[model samples]
Target: MPSSTSTSVSSFSHHFYTLLLLSVLLVAFFPGAFHYLSSLPFAYLSAASSPSSTHQPSSDQGPTTTATNTMSWFQKQFSLPPRSRGSYLVTDHVASAVPEIAQYKVGLLNLFVQHTSCALSLNENWDDDVRADMSDALDRIAPEAGPKGQELYRHSAEGADDMPAHIKSALIGASITIPIKDGKLATGTWQGIWYLEFRQVKHTRKVVATIQGEKA
Candidate 1:
């Protein structure tokens, strides 16, 4: 009986030492792999519990976010009466033309001029001298005639001021973007939209306005 017990104890000790050595080798050579294997059970538990434990809907309000917050767009085209070559304030004209703008709460207004010889800009609205001064400055930059009263450009198919008008139109932009809030333009107190006409003769211009925002 004593000899049988001693043999069984020796076999068990040999198996225990083999398993311990294998575990130590794995820990020393593949630490990351061991860690990932150890975390698999926890990850499985989390995934299994998430569906029932985390995403419980409330009794009152369901998913109402996308339905309530929707966006809309509006567009309009209007014409400006023929006027002499100069800078003219046209804020009120735009507002009157696009009455649909009042239906928006927060949005953007983009005013684009269809003609190439004319431009749109924002500048001082309260003073008339500013307009005259701006026109004078632009004229000096791109004059129609030289000092000897001679034409300076080659493209004069329209008139003496045709090339100069094109230059001015390129310098100043043909489009202006303004913020719309509470159904009105959010320009500063002294700021207004300017339609710069560079032609020598009075010409009618077309403007297209677009609005994008949420309704009030």
Candidate 2:
């Protein structure tokens, strides 16, 4: 027969370990329940940073729901009509083209222009003068092929403006990435997307939009 004192001591030990395990599990699953849980253990903190903490499956097994998946891929394409030489606001165009952009609660939208003579940028969308001014500035940097600034390069095989267009394109870039949040683009209120055309003749432009992240 066990002594009462031994039984009491065994019960105490069991309760102590049970409470400790409960504490760890509580902090691991519902961290917000206990404010002081951060002081508990290293194991709990490590679990918080684990990959599974946030990443959710992107399967279509159920209706699309908002989630911050560690990895997923959603894509879209935009074909804009003729835009004259200059920087133009395409925020609405983009939104229309990618209507499903709002499905993502948190993610990233990457814009890539297929043409080599154009660029994509994020800038002030309100003022038209800003676009014109930016166009003037870029043109000054890589002016069109002319006697005053540039002599159409040999590569002007495309056109007198083609060489400078390539220079301007390099100066800017062909792609941009913007974050997504709350089913909308996470850009500042004053920020807007722009399509910069560096060519003389207007033509249909194609932009590929690649979205990846948590779907809402």
Candidate 3:
């Protein structure tokens, strides 16, 4: 009976050792097995406890700031009417007339007349009738040709048109400065700028448009 009891206890001890050895052998051969088993739960716990990662823009990435820094100063010039006229119209097409000029985002525009008789003004360009009316009005104010100061007034040095041209220039003006925004003339919706050529004969009138702003 004592022998049988001892044998049973020894067998049980042997079985326990075998099970422990199998467990260690499995862990040693499949090294990543334990790691894989714990990975899912570990990942869940880590994600729950930690803050989420996200992307953010720096100062350089900001649109307005980038635009401001990228902007550059620029200038340009254009001619209008091609010839002297009694009535004329100015349009925004003038902006595109010079493709190179349009590349700059103009902030300030200065319009200059090369000739003394010619001048600049802002008016409606949409309607031809308006231009005709303006011409008629100017004609009424200063008639084309007639005697100056009765029959004999001294100063008539540079032809009849010369003095009259000077007078017309005085009545109208020479140069005008216009504010530009987003690379465009900032004239009112109904307003347009013009170069008034007072000469009767077709003259090469210049419209010097100077623009200052950012480059493309």
Candidate 4:
């Protein structure tokens, strides 16, 4: 009996020494093992204390109810339309339009013009001279009725301004995207949105402005 007990003790000692040597070898091979093992106790404690696991919903309760509850907290959506002709400052109009489309603060402001002849751009709106200078510059670059104008463009079924307008639209572009923050369009202090009307005749112009952001 004494011999058997000694054998059992020697076997346990050998196994313990082998396990210790293996652990040391693993730690030496992988330095991060110690950090990972050290964190296990804290992770176990955190899992034990987490409220979500403690308050799990019953299986009979449908997930749809929770989803519905979450969806009900969302803010309402909104949309606004504004039209302009000739030259106009649309900053105030944009500011006023946001209240109708979305109750939350604006994240992104997208201004798009439907007509190819008309377009949107950002420039100084404080002085009339700025606008006049822009108009004059455009005229200098692409005149309304001239030799270059007549030779380069032939699709003038809509009269002289038609082709010129198309040229100007191509030079400038038809859409502008602006950022919105705190219920206002976030443009530079000197910058303002401009609606460039290329046609000589009076025509109603439509501008579609969209605001996207999370609700307050």
How does each model score on TM-score? 0.71, 0.66, 0.57, 0.58
Error of 3 at 138 (Å): 1.9
Q: List, residue by residue over 1-216, the lDDT tens digit for candidate 3.
A: 579889999999999999999878978999888688769898889998885554446679874332343545444555665655565665554566544455656566677777787678888868878877876787667665555544232445765556666777888888877776665677888888776777767786766666666654
Cα lDDT, all candidates = 0.92, 0.86, 0.68, 0.68
Q: Which candidate number maximizes TM-score? A: 1
Clashes of each: 0, 3, 1, 2
C-alpha lDDT of candidate 3 relative to the true structure = 0.68
Which pairs of residues collide in candidate 2?
A: 65-216, 66-215, 66-216
Cα lDDT for residue 32, candidate 2: 88
Encode model 1's per-residue lDDT on 131-213: one tens digit a residue.
99999999999998999998799999988899999999999999999999998899999999999999989999999999989
Which 10-residue window of candidate 3 scores lowest in summed lDDT? 63-72
Pick the winner on lDDT between candidates 1 and 2: 1
Better of 2 and 3 by lDDT: 2
| Rank by TM-score (best first) | 1, 2, 4, 3
Error of 2 at 69 (Å): 4.9
Which scores higher on TM-score, 2 or 3? Answer: 2
Question: Which candidate leads in lDDT?
Answer: 1
